[model samples]
Target: MIPSVILLEKGASTIHADVGEILFHEDSMALFYYQVLNGRVRLSNFLSDGREVLHNVICANEGFGEVAILDNGLNTVTAIADSSCTLLKISSKKFFEIMHEYGHLHHVISQKIARELHFKLFMIKLIYNRSPEEILSNLIHKLNESKRLVCQECNRLMLTRQQLANMTGLRVETIIRTMKQMEKDDKLNIVRGKVFVPADGID
Candidate 1:
């Protein structure tokens, strides 16, 4: 994320968005830079077969739409609110101005952009080459790193089967079957509709 000056610039402002609202559309010009103040946002796109693919699930204190703005091009994916969200919306002009004024902030932002791209590419390769259980485990482990989907033990993951399916590109039924098998094998547990994977079992 960028500095406070970038967030508090002349044209910058905050907005509250409801869940399921479309913040922006894919292929549209990137007019603003958005940083999530709270709640979750999803950047996604549809595949050729009409299936939805989640490119990223962004949480609090994270920024999106920067790549498009930096390139002065269209958005590569649509951003939608996954929960009621508070966001800092800054005009691209002010955003660029502040970034240019702050060299260190620019370096941090560049590093974050590279990290995000690396994670996305890693997930893409995993989806094609790994087993469903392995895929689910890895996704859970990654989310836990941010503590966005963790529980008291830090070993428990609070996710529904459908959510897991959407993230892993598996059918809901497939996720359920695989999870049940994993449960029987003591690899994980499904209690009260939440998926739980022990920290050491996430290989």
Candidate 2:
């Protein structure tokens, strides 16, 4: 079974947030991490140029604040709700207690850290080196590998060009032009909102 923050014996610390509400400020010290029971959480990087670079989205049944919880440092990124949100919070003290009591919790925490490290490397590549197609492909593979995403329900599915671009941090226009070129070369088959690897093959 997937472990959830709602099940944690962390005390009475539930909170509600409206859309666009900041749950945790960037670089702020964390007293507790939260388990999202409902709604969406966006983890974003605010640039000096005033651009909001979206990093990742955390939906219901997810936990946040692990970075500070593990290292006793300020929040690395800001967390805000994208919609009405219900969160179950656990104090840092209680979090450590649970970790001490549960070996699996320790494993989960370690994996979270490792995954974030891998993600950061890809983000660096996306910003510095790779093309949109390469970046988008890496992004999808990263999502698929993350413990947070489950994909068993659907098979042989595909993504739209714009949809792929969002994850790659590239402009929609660039993605369109790149895809058009790929389509011409028969590197991909674009049909009815799905971009397939071949003209006819199983996903």
Candidate 3:
């Protein structure tokens, strides 16, 4: 993520979003580059059947909605506030200027996009005919590997069981059942109804 000083110097503004607020809809023109200063954002697509497919969760210090700006295209996914959030945003023109002025930012952005691609590819491979446990384990592993875990110290997951179901195209019940079994098998832990993975990650 670009430094706040840089973004503010380039005319960035801070915005507060309430939980469940829609920042932008799919196919909307990508007018700004957004970075979370606090809280979380969900990036997802709604299917024709009205089912949501989660693309990614943007946590504090992470940027979202950049691909569209970089590609000069419309947003491919809708961005919603997963929790009350403070975000910094700069117009696309100013963002481009910042990127041009700071060449190293390009590398940072490229790495983020590559991680997203890797996650998508991994999900596509695991979501088909994979066991619930396998899917969940891999998903957790990938999230941890990508530094997306909400609590890095305890390796707490960012998504709820329902969100996991949405991301993996599984049922909520299945996600819960599988996670319970995973805990029993020592693959993960559920304490007081909240889930946590190993700090070192699942095997």
TM-scores of the models, in the order given: 0.88, 0.72, 0.95
Quantify all predictions' global Cα lDDT against the true fold: 0.81, 0.67, 0.90
Q: Model 3: which ten-residue window has the lowest total lDDT?
A: 146-155
Better of 1 and 2 by TM-score: 1
Model 1 ranges off by over 4 Å: 48-50, 145-159, 199-201
lDDT of 1 at 31: 95
For model 3, how does the per-residue alpha-carbon lDDT over 143-189 read when each residue is reduced to its tens digit? 78767755787778878988998899999999988988899889898
Off by over 4 Å in 3: none
Error of 1 at 85 (Å): 0.9
Q: How does model 1 score by TM-score?
A: 0.88
- Clashing pairs in model 3, backbone N/Cα/C closer than 3 A: none
Residue pairs of candidate 2 with colliding backbone atoms:
none
Better of 2 and 3 by TM-score: 3
Judged by TM-score, which candidate is best? 3
